[model samples]
Target: MATELEECFHYFGYGNHLSNIHLHNKNALKVGIGKLVGYELHFGDFPASSSAKNCWKGGLASIQEKPGSVVWGVIWKMNQTDLEKLDRQVMGYRAKDVTVEKVDGGLISCRVYQLSEYIPAAPSTKYKRLMVDGAVENSLPNDYISKLVAIEDNGQTGAVDATLVDSEETKKTVTNGDGVHTSKAIHQSEGYFLYFAYGSNINSKRFSVSCPTSQKVAVGCLKEFCLEFAIKEQTSGEKFVGATIESRLNASTWGVVWRVDLTELPKLDRQEHIKEKFYEPVDVSVDLENGESVICRTYRVLQPYSPFPPSVLYKSVIVIGAEEHALPAAYIETLRSLPEGPEHTVGPMKSYYLEATKN
Candidate 1:
């Protein structure tokens, strides 16, 4: 049966003219049955003509050739019943005389039978689809980050219940603590901090609720890291290089930092989904408003199969009602104008912007 199919292909100059062709359906039956449905063959870069159609009338079933291209494939929707009838009426041969078996979804096994003698053609250089990188640049808005933190701090099941303070002073300041101005000295002396995030947590309404006292800043940084994408038991898919940049204060880089009671650190860890096995807290240096630098803690993914490639995302969040300094614009620009990454890329995660350190 295979010999017959090969002869037909040679006579029709299929192997030489067609590019990549494959069967669309994978779950096709294997055994040679008496009657079954035909195959659907996909050919890329087919010529727009009916030349192959006029050549073989009996064997040819249907052909779909795109216009203005030199690529084509055939589908022979023949069943065992038709084959048996053709053997008795058209060709003086019994069904047992011809070898017929199910090869694959797109091909059928056949014995020697030729309409015309022709030379086998060489393989064609045509492809089905081109490869593309799914990378994009996304800047995180400050309001969105605040909302995310609020959602995270609040419960995921319900909408956040944040109220605007009614004090005139609170309305004027970006960092008023929900209209509660008890101690003027405490409000004046409290320093602000920043933290940067570049991941699924970019949905800031949730993150803000998680850190209600923190404000979303419009600063970012560019950095490279490795991560994977999976749900529970799926294996590795594709490796990518991700980028991120920190927002700047005076001449230094600033990130989102939270100024909370020391006891809230544990809650922050949980809200950030910081499992010991998957992520670890690390201290890094960032720039402040007056050219000074400060050390801040951030979380990094430590899982084995993370698909986070080298790409960039915003990561800085601001703290309201705090006295921390900020980094300069030059510093932020330096981080943004980094060179184009190597081949593979990933990510456009959210970033934080915070006040600079006091030194």
Candidate 2:
């Protein structure tokens, strides 16, 4: 798009806009990674008049002029229409013309957005995840990625709120030609229940394999519950461990909460082997990062086995899922500290789980 011709403009994305997924969804063409000199990234408060405050309930990212500072971001080549769409999406930001330094030591003129007036604030976990994942996706400097990861959130989980939702959010259910509902958020509003996942299901890709109709709502913490790899499964006459949680004094288990519709309950139940009585759904109160608690349905082992280590592939899925969702680094380390089992499980999804960690 932004070739030698003048029909396109280079746009530098430093925040959640850095996500290629987001850019692609907006129909913007990603060019490459670049750096902006003398400008530093800042987490600024959403203006009171901006609708983003109601939707996000957290800080917003912006760039501020600062000497001797550099901000790394992805450069997207967008036409005039795409630029207009971007402007509408970023409500309070204003575009400014600037020059970006590409990796090949080439300078490119670009459009960068910034807030006219900045008020410092913390970002939400969801927003931080977007930026970190984008940085990793574009292979930005590891130190810069670490800096983005290290920034703290304001404790609001960026879960969709019914009353304060975006005006553009789908309000009606629309069925496609295949008879499948096109919008998952509409189901979330009408016939969905909260499901908490503390194991491998926390990874979006892994979770999608089993529960295609479900949508992640937020990250939650189940207090007084401790995670253990004690659910043993026999495959080819060998035992492999699976994850389960148990009540423990003063312990907390971090996990993801999903919004699942009643129609897909059968599918989820089948995956958990509900008919086989391997796991039973139990109701528990999961505390969200927004300081609110919600009742959620989660699975527990029906027959507890002796403590066993999980297979390397199994452990990799859980750890990768935890990291993929940008869960607390300390909790991820705890997952990483787990020892691998003697043998890997042979299952339909085994290859899928193993392939996920390579990225």
What TM-score would every model get versus the actual structure?
0.26, 0.52
Task: Supply candidate 1's per-residue lDDT for 277.
Answer: 27
Pairs of colliding residues, candidate 2: none
Mind giving the per-residue lDDT tens digits that candidate 2 earns over 49-130? 6544334556788998999999999998877756666676666788899999999999999988897665688987656755
Query: Which residue segments of model 1 deviate by more than 4 Å?
Result: 1-194, 198-204, 215-255, 308-359
Give per-residue CA lDDT, model 1, range 161-238, as digits (tens): 113222233334322211111221123334544455443333344355456665554333322222122211112443
TM-score of candidate 2 versus the correct structure, residues matched by position: 0.52
lDDT of each: 0.29, 0.71
Instruction: Please state every model's RMSD to the true fold in angstroms.
Output: 25.8, 14.8
Lowest-scoring 10 consecutive residues by lDDT in candidate 2? Answer: 175-184
